[model samples]
Target: MTVPALYRGLFDDAALFPPGDLPLPEAVPAHAVHRTAWYAEAVGPFLVGAGRLAELTAVLAGAPLRVALVLPDGAGQLAPALADAGALSVAGVELADPDVRAAVTALDGQLPAGVQAAVELPRGDGLPAALDVLAGTPYRAKFRTGGLAAGAFPTETELAGFLAGCAERALPYKCTAGLHHAVRHTDPATGFEHHGFLNVLLAAVAGPDEKLAAEALAERSGALLAAAAHDLTDDQVRQARERFTAFGTCSIVEPLEDLAALGLLTAPAPQEDR
Candidate 1:
């Protein structure tokens, strides 16, 4: 299950989200399986909603689990909730708050030490301001790459601008939603065009200008994306990862399978995946 160094800790388990909303009972063990998989190095922390803290605690009992918190209902009770879940190690937090400044202020006040945070910015005129607000803070930027419907996905132009904004600010970021495959492709069933994770990875690494970035995101060829990834030097890959970080996926295997298919990652030995 060897993967390019650029993809280490790239897939954060989001099995609790839509499209594959595995119940805690099912998701907990499935995440554990991913933690031990042959390509386990590519897997990041388990994403759990702030409200689901108690349920996750119950599922784990006394065992410790690495987690990235999602504040779907704002940042209410986040500190207390994490305090109560002594068995869970906090890796980071992600949330989309309309009042970016206030939310970041409150986060700085309540966020525990050593726990990283990301604030999602809308794909609109306010993005610049939001990124500006985050410029000096420890908080990073987050963007939504795709969703269930066509409307849920950002256009190539919009996505490219977002990447360019982050690159200009030297802000590290993460992406969630709609990136199911390694290369951009239109889904036949939904007629929705999904951005590819590999495309985004390369874009972040190169920090291309807006036009070139948009072109990269719109690329549908797996070979081109893989070749771009292969061309990057180790330092460039590391720099790109520092900016791109990881992305959330409903199923960890999907990304791994896609990488294997694209020859970016080596397939596991038969029966070795388990």
Candidate 2:
């Protein structure tokens, strides 16, 4: 029942996890990991430069690890560390450079073996091109949008479209931002904002039920979670359960371990590989 824990990006601060209702031991594990990166969501703007990043990296690398780095640009940011690391930046395009193809191929030469890389695509059509550019590496991809504000949620159709696009492209991308709580609960304290996996999960399962699908998409809170999950047939329930058994978790790390007490996800296998 060792659940997959949440990796708080630079945005989540030390205070974010401390106020939870969960027990002290469970609420704040010996080490709660945070990240170091430059972004609006950055936990501490003053401490996000190169020096803080190095320190945070070192801390997370240690036992009882409580900090981490979700480098938006994995390799490009770390290229200096790994002489072979290659970094791809978006100097032209709004979200990415307009001429990424040339830049990528240019770095191909100095890109040492196992050099990591990341490309930020500015607008539409960049998805495919990005997939093509980072094709043969351990590179992972992320999609960004402008509407993660307090109460801004993309249209139901828009989210479905995005996820559909991911499915169509066979892209298993990870999401950051707007997802912080277990359900769609509001951040009682910060009033900042957070969207948990439960909503995403419900939306994914709602494809067959258009009405149900629409309701979940329009709302930005966890209200839909309880309802969307309602009315689902036994078969659908089973399917959703299977999905959860797979990679489903809106990591409230402490309580998630609680669910495993109920025989939810299969017990993780040994770490022989590790």
Query: Over the stretch 28-127, how does candidate 1's per-residue lDDT look in tens digits?
Result: 9998888887788899999988778888999898787899988755556456656765768988888667888877887889888898888887778989
RMSD of each: 2.3, 10.6
CA-lDDT, candidates in order: 0.85, 0.37
Candidate 1: where are CA atoms >4 Å away? 268-274
Maximum-TM-score candidate = 1
Per-residue C-alpha lDDT of model 2 across residues 1-274, encoded as one tens digit per residue: 1322211121222222212323323323322431221121212111122223344444334333322223333334433433211122111111123455643553454444543333444335555566556445333334442233544434455445544454444443333344544354455765644444555556545544545544555566444454554556667655443322122112334323332332332344556865
- Per-candidate TM-scores read 0.94, 0.46
Worst 10 residues of 2 by lDDT: 85-94
Candidate 1: clashing residue pairs, number: 0
